[model samples]
Target: MQIRLLDLLSRIKRLQEEREILRRNQALELLKTLKKEYEELVEERKKVSQVFTKSRFFKAVELQDLIRLRDSLLEWEKIAEKKLKDGYEELAKIEEELLERHKERRLFERLKEKEMWKQSEEELKRLYRELDELALLIQGQENKR
Candidate 1:
């Protein structure tokens, strides 16, 4: 029963760790994508602004479009930053718990191994004693013969 419980808990911890890892990877990947998109938007906006500056005339419509794009991208980046921060914190917590669970599981496994060794030793001793008795009985019968 104890071993079963330990095994179950170990499996649970491993699963929890796997889930956290996946979440962290996904969060990081999203952040990377957002960064790439933001960079592309900035480059596109810079090119347009430069073109307008050289012409010495601001096209109000184009300027407004650029502003909207920048605003939306910034908003997305803000949200993604928050999500990444939260995910990192959660992953840290899960990792800490995983470390503790691993220690506990290792201790239990060691104790279980020691107990099994003791039982085997006792069984071997019993077998030896039985063999000794059988040998004595055979000797007696041969002497009578």
Candidate 2:
């Protein structure tokens, strides 16, 4: 019924807020990770370039380290990218759900108003009858109290 719908609406609103917070946290985390990765990549590239400059034949250990750094950087970048995309997707869904909640709230408000108006009309009619009876009683008051 209406109560159930209202409860559901509140739950949905809370969920939407929770999702928004999560999305923001994910975005911030992704940015931090990406920045760290970029800094590391820059430092590694600088070192690798220095090694290449100093000697034509790169040592196996240096080559391996360079490759490993590159691969690790790539993996971190991919993870950040995926997290960013997921954060945006969650935000979009939350927004859509919020819109739906607004629509439901509006519908509920309209229905509530209509019910209130009907009750008021009925009460006014009943009060009018009572007023008429009181007026008649006052007019023929043989013993005014």
lDDT of 2 by residue, 1-145 (tens): 5545555665666666566666556666766776676566667666766766778776899788867876776676567666656766765775666566566666665665666677789899999999999988988795575
Q: lDDT per model, in order?
A: 0.69, 0.68
lDDT of 1: 0.69
* Lowest lDDT block of 10, candidate 2: 1-10
Error of 1 at 18 (Å): 6.7
Clashes per candidate, residues 3 or more apart or on different chains: 0, 0
Residue 63 Cα positional deviation in candidate 1, in Å, after optimal superposition: 1.7
Best by TM-score: 2
Encode model 1's per-residue lDDT on 50-77: one tens digit a residue: 6657776557997688668766766765
Off by over 4 Å in 1: 1-56, 124-145
